[model samples]
Target: MTDDQYVAFGLSPTSGKPEMLNSDIVVAYYDKDDGSFHAVDYSVTARSQCDGTYGMCPDERVNGRNDASVIGGERRNGVTSITFSRPYETNDQLDMPISRYSDPITVIAAIGHLNTRKEANYHDDFVTKSNVVLDFTSSEGNSCSTLVGGGQETPRYLPWPANIIPRGTTNFTATIGPTGGERGYSALTRLADSPSWGLAWWINDLLIPEIYVERGQTYYFTVYGGNDHLNSARYHPLYITSSPEGGFRQKTVDEQNREQVFAGVSYSKMGMPEPTAVGDMCEWRHTAMDAWEDSLTFEEYKDTLYKKCDGDLAGSLVWTVETETPDLVYYQCYSHRNFGWKIHVVDSGRKERQEGNNRGSTLLPTPLLASLLLATTRLLR
Candidate 1:
């Protein structure tokens, strides 16, 4: 099953246009015995003129070059999923260089099938030419201002108002410190929400603020609490849960119970002494932990974004929010309660109109500004 299955990304939505000079296509094959897939190779193509079909001829400059590599893959329930990685800048003239700090990039996607000879066939109807663009480096949602040009400038964080919800990839820096005389998980990068002022001072280390995140977006929480003095993180490891009052050591019956309360995606460390390993000292025992383990394959577990470190100086927890995420969840300590805050999950596209209404007169609206910037950037390229 290693033939005729592929995904293509073109710089231009139109496949047979002159702008399709450096489009990238990844070809994959499947293994029936192991129920796994592999991205075998990639091709850089070009089309100097329209060919009346949605196909571009391979560019001769890099005809035999292969830069794509398979990370992991699996096929189950008739659905095949493959995870692959490629460099943002491959330095190949026939390939498009993805900028780390540039504006959103517009591209086309297509899929192909197998032929009678077990070779890749033409894609009849499996193509997507939507207007939506993707920003791979967007770590602070749509509100964060990205640096243009090609300098190594960090993205400027914009205050997220209460009324305006967040969308796209969001980042949060987590720190452990004394809040109201009690040690709690605080978001150092997120500004505290103030109803009267619309936004409060930065470094919300004292507020223990509730986090609002949108569905269908990726979130990265850089946890510095583990590196705090006296290794406070060893006892206050943060976790997301459905229960407002954490049930880490709660009893269900008066006689005997070892049930721990945990919900959603929990945390795990990167290397040895894995938190999920059975019989390990740092093992996480909970109902949700069992569910999380059962839901993932070995490959999926290896590539999971959920991460945590108990006594390490620094760590991170990443969660790609899905529709199944509960509307209300709490971020509480694994060993203790009330050390974290609420996490509100909102649906996508619900905040577009609200964000438009909240824009200032001096600044252009997000949609308009994005379009203008994208067009300008493309012309300059």
Candidate 2:
């Protein structure tokens, strides 16, 4: 059935509840005569006020479902473009394969429309849909050629073309995954931590990437908590925090134990030292020596002053970039406020080393050093 099919209906099937009202439309289908790219999921129900008219009820049929293949669309003017075909390898084990070219496959979307049909309910609206990355090695043409397909309405952010981590930011690695939504809606995935959800921080390993830094340069982040889709029961507990405001929505459970109010500071009243209670989950500091105060201990401040890693913050924890840090620094995830990472701190190597020492002190002073500095300023006047 195809009437411009791009249905991403009300998702939450694993108990974030709210199923079938609409939300979760992430379709990235690209198959330029077999270069391949297909990852689809759908289900959409609507009726906010049909008897009155706010979003204007029904032309209804959005009920597509479960993994890869055979969907097509076209709605024109009001916009709705869709086309589908799947198989770069698919037995549909929740599908994910468009092989070769490695990194660039992240495309998460959300949509649950209904402004009024007498409003029976349908809008937990996961911040209104938008995520794009369907590049199958673009030599400039045909990667789904100009791509605007699928009942068109998937845009809330789309601007992926900036890596920025260059200026001495070391081999950083932040990879965590699985967020079709239902977790906290994303810092990577958070609903706090509900049944161990997911969250992310992917730079260098790519996937959900973002982490650019400079300001006095000394950054290091490893945090790869396992992901190849699910990494065998993925041992969650991950951590990293900073926020001048780029991420933070914990909502409660003491905002997921406050985690020192998300790095603004207040670690249990600053006497620093408290994580050794191994039976209720809070003791995994790899080492930051007594974990840098502020009353330390939620496992010594999320394992050594907010670097927290059990599966992969990656060897020796490694983190330095902090001269007071905060150009936007949110590598978050206490219990999950959407998981974590906004990290953008630029001074650009202290403004290109103060513009090369002010262009080497205003040049032109070399005529024998300006005649010995004007004969030592007239013998020091």
Candidate 3:
């Protein structure tokens, strides 16, 4: 799954060109004996360029490498997909460095590949089977009715593995939590959780309108997330997020303009989902939807969008402003892993914006401004 905030594009900062790196894995498990859900496996391709096809570590020195994997999947529409982590299913593993580019790229795909071939190799080749259990709480817990050891209780699926347990008899039902998957939604969740639906990247964690970075300057941005206190939180659900703090906050996307509120990290906790084990992946894919190609400059893209959507300074929607409004002044289209353009705003010394008019003035008067001016003239008369 691609991270919503950063678009993944294969770019080699080292090579300074588009890259078609190979890195992907796909694994599946089938019943060999009773065929009662035996083998469980997730794929892995060492070459996977998750943060947009590229090497996480260009070499060994920059061992800023990370390890990731994916697991737990059932065939649906003939396609297999699931979240990353253990207990439920695992994705492939990616342990790459962060120095490949001056900017760090996080591969936000299916992850946490436990119980794959690695885990299965725990016992001996003659392993009978102690992997799964009926108890949603205790995966290998005793069966409810039979009180037997093998409680091969099938759990429900999820976009990501949700803490759930199984319950009841004969019916084979499971829930999402508390009772340990009593509703048996795992299969559905697993079915629904796909590469397309794969949101391995923390949507809210990714910074919005990813800072149209400054090139050659060498950038460093950290993404932080957590819950109230982070008890079991390696990183909690609602800490300082990497993405835009929702509400009436700054944004680059059109859909976000409707926000009635703005940046308030406190409220984000109560209103948002608790952070899960699955981490955020920040990928960058170069895009030129609003321009000719990667060659398009940030100023050009902004000028173009201003021209296409709001027109030039002549139109009410468009304004050649003295200052930049991150939200109102969009300068990008489509998306790259985490950026659309790199810009450096250089304030010229000679340019003194016309102060005779309100600073908000563009090329035309706003209808509201025009109305106010006319009313003032009549009152003076």
Candidate 4:
């Protein structure tokens, strides 16, 4: 693995443990000199430490005896593909047994480079956002799925490029009601009935739409969860996270302890000069509903009422995407689970080119417009 790129898969013997330390994992890489794939067994005994600090350190390892065999692999077009197999029951303490009749297993996958000395380096955010569960005994065959949070139904819309929001100081009229298309706050009611019910977000007119944004652009989310609107919005404070399905509350204890905070280009960095009344942004109205009008611009709200704002009735969040921002992020309710959707960050140059090409036409293409309209009508009903 000298100076070669590699992919590692960490398997948790338990259902929800995805951490590498004290767990069984397999690392695979392509050997360019031999023109073959290689797999190594590894188990991290302790997290790396530096300068008396205990966390966020480099890769440290206590190698395990090799037990995996590579079936085949190849490198083509800058992509490395590999296939490997291991015993379902390796009696070695470092090897976690895979039972075909057992429950689903959690898997964490990551990619990173190796130094000149062939030592694996740290993966700087080049990892899966959430642990994926794999079912071995499913009648439907080997299948993988994300563990949906809050027991809420899966989001209906798939992430589509045509639904992208271009760069600029775009304003979003944010509200909290039912997950889009529902008649009431069913999730909240379900949660009241059972603690497992999750929350959801409704942005503008869409229910938890997977939004695509451009780096170096600004977004102004004008939230409205006052007395005039649904009470659910009052308790749902929106925040951005690098983890999907709202990393606020995860299934595993280790994951729950991990910091899911994404502090880049946030309200705190924007010189709020005061703590938010609730969580990240200023409340829409601290007292009377009529105190703040919908006609007020983001700048106006920021300059006057933002600093003194307090309470959870409603609020606004401003994000200025930086170039180094992760390609994928999520806008989630701070206090609940799975209440938001994915935000895909794209290069500003690419978005600018798309916008320029569309400048000739003020309207969307007929087919796209019709599809959007139909979706809106269905959601409204």
Work out the TM-score per prediction.
Answer: 0.30, 0.25, 0.18, 0.33
Segments of candidate 2 deviating more than 4 angstroms:
1-7, 10-16, 19-71, 75-78, 83-381
Residues 124-173 of candidate 2 have per-residue lDDT tens digits of 33332343444454567554444344555533432222233434556665
Name the best candidate (by lDDT). Answer: 4
| lDDT computed for candidate 1 | 0.42
Query: Least accurate stretch of 10 residues (summed lDDT) in model 4?
Result: 48-57
Give the per-residue lDDT digits (tens) of candidate 4, residues 53-152: 1211222332245777899875654556677887888777667788899888888776654433333333322466566887766768444353433354
Report the C-alpha displacement of residue 204, candidate 2, in angstroms: 15
Tell me the deviation in Å of residue 153 in model 1.
54
Residue 190 C-alpha lDDT in model 3: 29
How many steric overlaps are in each model, in order? 3, 30, 72, 2
Error of 3 at 178 (Å): 31
Candidate number with the higher lDDT (1 or 3): 1
Query: Which scores greater on TM-score, model 1 or model 2?
Result: 1
The lDDT for every candidate, in the order shown, is 0.42, 0.35, 0.22, 0.49
Candidate 4 has what TM-score?
0.33
Question: Candidate 3 — worst ten consecutive residues by lDDT sum?
Answer: 171-180
